[model samples]
Target: MHAWMSEASLDRADNRRKVPEWVSAQWRRPGARLLLVDSDGQVATDETGSGPAGVPTSGNYNAQLHTFLGLVDGIPWFTTEGPIIGPSASLRHLGAVTGGAALELTVGAVALTAWHRLEPHCSGCGARTRATAGGLTRRCPVCGRVQFPRTDPAVIVAVIDPDDRILLGRQSSWDPGRMSVLAGFVDAGESLEQAVHREVFEESGVRLREVRYFGSQPWPFPRSLMVGFVADSVSAELTIDRDEIEEAAWFTRADLAADLAEGRVIMPGKASIAHRLITAWQGRLLG
Candidate 1:
């Protein structure tokens, strides 16, 4: 798994049929801390510290701002619905998450914010939706329709051939000779395994088999889950789809090392699952 997607120690208590009653009674709990964040998942902190120890939830927010982000270590956490409010909070972006308990909190907050931002109307009848399940659900009063947040799934794979060479490709938008594994969105009614084979073949014209699961990552730039895999190619024939891939190649470990040493090939960033998957395979397969 990519370091950013590693598990953080948080108990969201998602199975609770109703919002915790304690959310309404947190003020009486002497040690309770209600985390406050704006639409961007940024939390206000004490001017002196990096931690969100001084976030004020009352000065500029009300009940409407609340997005109950389940319990963390028995203390309640809440995210606000308006513009980003924190001056000192950290921002976790694609491929960059300094894992701590707070990273999960930030990801959860941001995912919810995206749900609220992107979906305002019920899909069933086009009625304006309102929060009903402590912001976990958006319900329509006019049509009795309910909506939930969406997390789009995608597949990313590294293809290998009989000689143990890795298959990598470059897209038109990338810098020259910069190559990474092939990836694409999983289409409707398609299994993940099917998506992997379909995407790899579609982009590079390579037949793949022995598709195996590698790892997963949450790329929440907007909202995407990157599923990783490693597969073996049935043959090594180049049929580049100029519209999709600019170039494709098979690389032995030495080929990769030479290009990397000469600054001809740039690997994916460390924060990505692609980098991790490639690194893992290189360590196990390299002579």
Candidate 2:
């Protein structure tokens, strides 16, 4: 199941009940931990901090933290942490904590981490803004600009041919034998369909037509909205752009199934919308 769906179900269930007293009680518990973030884009952990008396130590400075709970896809989630200090000394020791997974550092995890640190100062007036409303937003006292999480909307399309083949691309940066759908961020002033057509043509040098929207997913790997689609290949020629993709090719349904079985070609991971789109398409064809 997708993380969003699981979280949504939890959220829907929470809505029917009263705000549990235990939820509030957890806030009062002393040992309940919070993930701390610093300005250098690092998370605070238990490995490096001064003791309460200012002695050299290894733990987070947990005072003055914020707290909030909300539903994403109806899941009950909470964030309780303090503002990030860019030059804080505590940030240097983050590697010693939790093996460098940012998600493990704090309650907000990876989804809420980047946005909170990205806009610490107001972009409009260049004045320092304060994290308010329990880390849900940043407010500029000087310019009164309220900032929230920014999610880049991107289109991921599976181009299909009249022969029932799907187009896939392999990027140089990916692990060995990994292939996935062509995807790109929706440029300013371009519609989703326009982006799908533009990116596919640009990367693969193949024109597309009859683009159809499949579905969408909220990819919170630092905030991205993935819009999935299926497009018809108008041309058969493969013109791969070496700069963007190492290889582009068409695969038949049988070939895809074999790849899945042998793990010869790694598809998109389960956390991503790309995986969902590709799996759904494969089911439609194989069924």
Candidate 3:
């Protein structure tokens, strides 16, 4: 699967959350659960470390910050910060381990919790805002301004040339031998396709055509929607930008296999869309 847990497993009752009484009813419902989000932006994990470890909604918690996540298999789920019961892990690690509704819940919990922590004050009035709408929005009491959660859009593309070789680059900050497809944030006043073309040229100096949407993933490290794509480059000539891309090169399937086998090239993990994009071009799984 391109996205392991990106299906509609949870019913996000947006309208229901707007009603205070309905939200309270859900909280009192039997089988209601609470997932703990830590200060480090990590979620509590089960003993196996592959699934979420939700408490029985039995302990003390800051109800104001308790965000209603929605229902998974007819069970209500909410997220709030409290004592982590067991081991905690980041979304990157959780993505690699879980699937289905659990993955969706964890993603939502992390994203909403992080947003709540970061956006406790109003951007417009510099006044403290309170969480409302089941933590979906924050309202400034003094300014009467409501703030919504923000998600930054980014484009990640797997670029292929006429020879069927894939273009991969290494960022200056990345570890040695680690490489992935070209990606960048969507600039203001730019379309997704335009961002794809601009990012490829700005980083690797390769103009692309046949740009196609591949898939998308919710990367909530600090809230971002990763839009994935595949494109064909006009030429394979390298004009690497040393500032963004430390090194870039075209790789045939054979070359990639050899490098990976020898531990000379470290591909992204199975959790990221970058891995899916590269493997799609490679015509098989890399790991």
By TM-score, the best candidate is 3
Ranking by lDDT: 3, 1, 2
Candidate 3 deviant stretches above 4 angstroms: 1-7, 59-63, 284-287
Evaluate all candidate structures by whole-model CA lDDT and list the values in order.
0.71, 0.61, 0.87
Preferred candidate (lDDT higher): 1 or 2: 1
Report the error of model 3 at residue 180, Å.
0.4
Query: In candidate 2, what are the lDDT values of residues 125-185, reduced to their tens digit?
Result: 9898776554556779998999876889999998887787889999999988899999999
lDDT score, candidate 3, position 230: 88
What does candidate 1's lDDT look like per residue over 220-252, in tens digits?
656888999889889988688889888889998
TM-score, prediction 2: 0.70
lDDT for model 1, on a 0 to 1 scale?
Answer: 0.71
- Which portions of model 1 miss their true places by more than 4 Å? 1-8, 26-56, 59-63, 81-97, 175-177, 285-287
Q: What is the TM-score of each candidate against the true structure?
A: 0.82, 0.70, 0.95
RMSD of each: 3.8, 8.5, 2.3
Model 3: per-residue lDDT, tens digit, 70-169? 9998898999976686788888888887878888899999999989888899998899998877888898999999999899999999998988899999
